[model samples]
Target: MKYSLFTELKSREVIDLFRSVFSESEGEAEGQVISDFVSSLLATTKPQDLIGCIAEENERVVGCVFFSRFTVPSGQAAFILSPVAVSTEVQGSGIGKELIGYGLDHLRSQDVNLAFTYGDPTYYSKMGFKQISENIVNAPFPLSQPIGWLAQSLDGQEIQAMAGPTQCVDALNDPGLW
Candidate 1:
């Protein structure tokens, strides 16, 4: 098991990694969906979002996690993690935990304080993510993975309040995403 910076990810192999690891639920995705979901995931986005960190094993990407910058109602900045995936072949191996730990540490170093994601409470809860109703900042979609929408605070305390919609600013242009 190895952790790689998401920005270092490239090549056809990485795309294969995304597709293979995410295959289980692709059936629920629209027919127009493409694998380029990874293209714009970076800190370089207009609002400075975080890209995904991946876990590679035996020369293959087995796990993936990505974060995006967003504004809460109080105008404070936060990071929203989304679309984490680990291939069935590598499930229950602590790879996801390592990825989250890496991301949280990375965010902390950069002074990013808050994170939002929709995922399994049982799984993400262990990583400090909780279901906070008032501070919810969501993706463009209706949060298909209800159980996955979770939040965590790392470099700060209590999430800022929100009033308007929580969006990724430019996530709509990505062909790889839903």
Candidate 2:
């Protein structure tokens, strides 16, 4: 498998990968929701504020992940990982984790101080994320699953409490997505 940064040329393929994977694991409606969300993210977000990564094999996109610029009141450089997908056939092969790790490495090299994500704790814990409360750093929207709010300090320092609300890119600003 090959890991690389996402390019606009692969936009359709990446979106389809997310749609198909989510549709299988969740449902068709959920898949369409994710597909629309990714489409908006790719179209509306500024290049500097979005970073995407993909895993490919035999010239097909097998796994994909996206990290968009996240804003905190404290002005720390941060990003949020969301809506990750691994092709059903490759789910257990670590492609998702590897794609995420690759994205995080790129963020670190770019001087990002923190990384946040909302997902299953058991799964994200393997990638060094720890459950965090909104008191420490609020999510852009009120979370239906507060326990899924997770973060990791990329600079090896403890995550400090940031006062006021957090903001995600326009595409992720939907309340339903939380």
Candidate 3:
């Protein structure tokens, strides 16, 4: 598998991959929701704030993930990972993990100070994310699954408590998404 940053030309493929992957895993309705979310993310977010990553095999995109700029009161460079998808056929393989690692490496090189993601703690923990409380760093919206609020400091320093609410990009600002 090869990993690389995605360009606008691959937008449709990336969106389709997420839709199909989520449909298989979470049913059709939820799939459509994720697809729409990705569409909004691609269309509305500024280029500098959105980073798309893809895993390709035989020139076909098999897995994809996105990390968008997130804001914290402390003013450090931060990003939030969301809507990760790996093809159902290749779920057991390490493609998802490697793709995420590639994205994080790219972020680190770009001087991103911290990374946050809302998802299954068991799976995200494997990626070095630890559960963090809202008091430490607030999420943009009230989380239905507080346990899944996870984050990691990309720099060597530990995460410090931020003073106010965290803000995600417009596409992810929906309360229902949390």
Task: Please give me the total number of clashing residue pairs in predicted model 1.
Answer: 9
Tens-digit lDDT track for model 3 on 1-178? Answer: 9999989999999889989999999999988999999999999999999999999999999999999999999999999999799999999799989999999999999999999999999999998899999999999999999999999999999999977878899999899999
Better of 1 and 2 by lDDT: 2
lDDT of 1: 0.65
- Tell me which residue pairs clash in candidate 2: none
What does the lDDT read for residue 159 in candidate 3?
A: 98
The candidate 1 region of ten consecutive residues with least summed lDDT is 27-36
Top candidate when judged by lDDT against the true structure: 3
lDDT over C-alpha atoms for residue 21 of model 3? 93
lDDT of 2: 0.94
The most accurate candidate by TM-score is 3
Better of 2 and 3 by lDDT: 3
Cα TM-score per model: 0.75, 0.98, 0.99
Q: Model 2 misses residue 63 by how many Å?
A: 0.5
Better model by TM-score, 1 or 3?
3
Q: Relative to the true structure, how large is the alpha-carbon lDDT of every model?
A: 0.65, 0.94, 0.95
